[model samples]
Target: MKERVRAVLVTADDTMLVIRRTKPCIPEYWVLPGGGVEPGDESREAALHREIHEEIAGKAHIIRLLHTMESEDERQLFYLARIATWSFEDRTGPEFSAEGRGEYMLEEIPLTVEALDGINLKPDEIAHVLRGTMEAGALGDGAAA
Candidate 1:
């Protein structure tokens, strides 16, 4: 199975970082900032931190391992991260893709169940994650407000 990593990067203002993927294969989709692990990576968490810095140009503290998703063809690891600072102009990492997917537009949106529900975010892994986070009592009480 293929393996990858991602981050749910929440900022101090209660917004989460998302990227508009420019890849032709995806066409106008949004996702959290991250990528597949590299052979040079020391650890998964270390790769996550490095990826966050590359994707959004920010520093982040990993809150926890939110979920691990397994499928017939792939496995994905998602982590909860509190972001510190960033800049879209300085953002990197889209270049790492094998297809050389380019020019991702970074965005910040409120971290709410509604925000999550409003979009058709994909990979099924994310939807599974929402259910897990909710079941584990992982979400904040005031998030929907």
Candidate 2:
């Protein structure tokens, strides 16, 4: 069973840091700033810290386990976080660069329900869930709470 973790860093203005997957070469998709959970990882949170750093050069505070999804033999954990600063010039590491899953395009966009309304979001599933999840008040902040 393979497991992965991603940190969905939302900004004060409600935008998300996303990465366009440029490898595996199958109908390219987008994902949050994160990577796999390695044995060297001290913990899940530690992995999140490392992944975000490598993927988006992002530093954030993990708020909670926002969502969990499983497919066949793979499991993905998405965390809700707040990012203070980030830079694409610093994004680097194995499995996500010249040493791994090709190159990735780091993009940030408004994290809104409209993202699901044919907004050309990547990783179709992500855009699908974001709208309902945020609107359901599951994020615990209630959009304005």
Q: Which residues of candidate 2, in runs, are more than 4 Å off?
A: 22-27, 99-102, 118-125, 137-145
lDDT of 2 by residue, 1-145 (tens): 7888987777777777777666665666676777789999999899999988886777888888877888999888888888878888877766543565566787776665655353445446666677788678565373231
Where in model 1 is the C-alpha error above 4 Å?
Answer: 23-27, 94-103, 131-137, 141-145
lDDT of each: 0.73, 0.73
* Worst-scoring 10-residue span by lDDT in model 1: 136-145
Model 1 C-alpha lDDT versus the unseen true structure: 0.73
TM-score of each: 0.80, 0.80
| Cα lDDT of model 1 by residue, 17-129, tens digit | 88766665665667777777888999888888888888767888887777788889977898887877887667666574546555567777666666766665666568657
